[model samples]
Structure formats: C-alpha cells, structure tokens
Target: MKDGNLDSIDKRILYYLQQDARRTSSSDIAERLDLSASTVRTRLNKLENSGIVRGYHLDIDYDLAGYPLYTKIICTAPVPDRDSLASQAQEIHGVTAVREIMTGERNVYVNAIGTDHDDLNRISKDLDALGLEIVDEQLIRDEYVCPYHGFIDEGDDPAPDDVDEVETE
Candidate 1:
C-alpha cells in the first residue's frame, strides 16, 4: 500500500526483514520486538499482499560463482516502449535485472553478468536487437546494500531539547 499506511510495528518488521530475510525468522523478530510470532507472520503476510515486500532476493556473488564480469548497460528507448523494452531485456541470456527510469534519455538500465567480454558483448547485441540504444556500459565492481534507516526503532523518542531546537528552526 502507501507509506502513510505503515505504522511503527510495520516499519520495524520491514527493517528486520531487510537486514536478513532468510536468517531472520518471524520467531526471531518476535523475540526481539517482544511481539507474538503469529503477529509477525500476519504483518509479513500483509506486507507481501500489499506489494510492499515484493520478494526476498539472493545477494549473489557472480565473481565468486565463476561469472567474473558484471556490467550495467544503460540504454535509451522510445518513451512509449521503455517499459516493454526493459521487461524484454531480462530475457537476454546474461541479463540479471532490468530497471526503467521515469525521466531521462537513458531511461533503461540492464544489469548483466558474464564469463568474459564476449559474453557481455552478446548481451549488449541482444539488447540492441530489442530496439534499445545502448548509451553506455560500465563494469560494476561491487555493490553495498542495507536496510532503510528510517525504519529502525531508535528505542527512544527525541529529547525535549531536540524538540526545542526544531521549534527554533
């Protein structure tokens, strides 16, 4: 649903899930939040049903897995065809993910992994065949990801001094 619909409990659940969905079970979260396991499960169900918690994805290390090449191919597509083209790009052999941007000439980004330059070139050609103009391709070294900080419970409300500072501002 919308951001406004999420209460503190829902945000905390999201925070824990983001940290490690596979290792962190509802029971684990329940223990930490002092909530019932059933409540955590129900909240997770609601999040998933509302499309907020889309899916738990694997953080794959292609480099360690024998695919030593990772690239992000930025592309430009006809505005009307951007979404479809991005979706179709995923069908290319090396493509791992595709994203559609809302505003810009280079509106589609394709993340692909390959064994070598040849494999990446093939993926690029496949994207071209789908009518996306390859703007540029960059080799990705590493990526860092973490939970949204705003979802974290600081365990204490702001002090009166902090509130006074805000009022002064």
Candidate 2:
C-alpha cells in the first residue's frame, strides 16, 4: 500500500514496533491503544504483507561487542552504476550497510564496523575495488534512532515535545 493508505492505527502500530519490536507484543500495544490483540495482529500482518514493515532488526552496539571501530565510507560511483555498486558493497566483509543517494556526485555511502584500523582499511580497499572512489572515510562515534512521531494523528494524545518543528516555505 502507499503512504496515503496507512491510517492512524497502522501508523501507531509502526510507532510502537519501532520503540521495541522484540519486546512489544500485540497484547502490549493493545493495552496502550485500547485495540484488541487480534486486530493489532491483523494490522501487523497487513503491514508485513504490503512490504511496509520489512523486517525487524536488532540495534547492535559494535563498541560494546568488541568491534570498537565504526566507520562511514563516502564514495562516488557513476550514476548508472550506483545501484549495482551499492548491492555489491553489502557483500564485502565488514560492510554493514550501503546507501545509494540520488542526485549527487558522491552517491554511495557505506557504513562499516571493524575490530581495528587494519580491519577498516581492508573494508575501504574492498569498496574501492568495486569501482567506488573513496571520497572520504570518517570514524563514527555513535548512532541514534527514534520512531517517527508523524505517524500518530494530532487529534490523538500529544506527541513528545523533544522533536523540533521545521518550518519550510
């Protein structure tokens, strides 16, 4: 389904799933939203079937897991080859994620985690071998994630005030 097809209930289901998909059960969400467990499950199934839910993922702390080095490798690839290059980048060892950016000279971004300098260096070389010119390499300290509160309707309970509203002309 399209973005417009996602109603308030569907969005709230997504919001709660983002919070903690592993621990957040349908019963738990039902209690909060006053929705029935079966209804939540049905909605969740619809979301997954429509490919909106995709898959739940673990938030890993590479530093705590003994891979202390996290890095982002910025690269440029020919516009025509960006998509294929990004898919290939994921096959490289230590490369955790690859993003293909549209409308930019530096079009591909790769995030990698490694045990040390040598491991990161190897990842960089592998990416370069795949025809992605290494524009820059950054030592990443930390990453943060939060659910998109825009999913919830304004008529519902107040959203968290932590997010700053951006005004656009």
lDDT for each residue of candidate 2 in 25-129, tens digit (9 for 90 to 100) = 999878778989999999999899989988999888889899999999999999988999999999999988899998778899999999989999999999989
> What's the lDDT of the predicted structure labeled candidate 1?
0.85
lDDT of 2: 0.86
Task: Give the runs in model 1 whose Cα sits over 4 Å from its true position.
Answer: 1-4, 153-169
Overall lDDT per candidate, in order of appearance: 0.85, 0.86
Residue-pair clash count for candidate 1: 0
Worst 10 residues of 2 by lDDT: 160-169
| Reference-based TM-score, model 2 | 0.90
lDDT of 1 by residue, 68-112 (tens): 999999999999998889889988998999999999898999999
Provide the lDDT at 44 for model 2. Answer: 92
Top-TM-score candidate index: 2
Best by lDDT: 2
RMSD of each: 7.6, 5.1
Q: What lDDT score is found at residue 16 in candidate 1?
A: 74
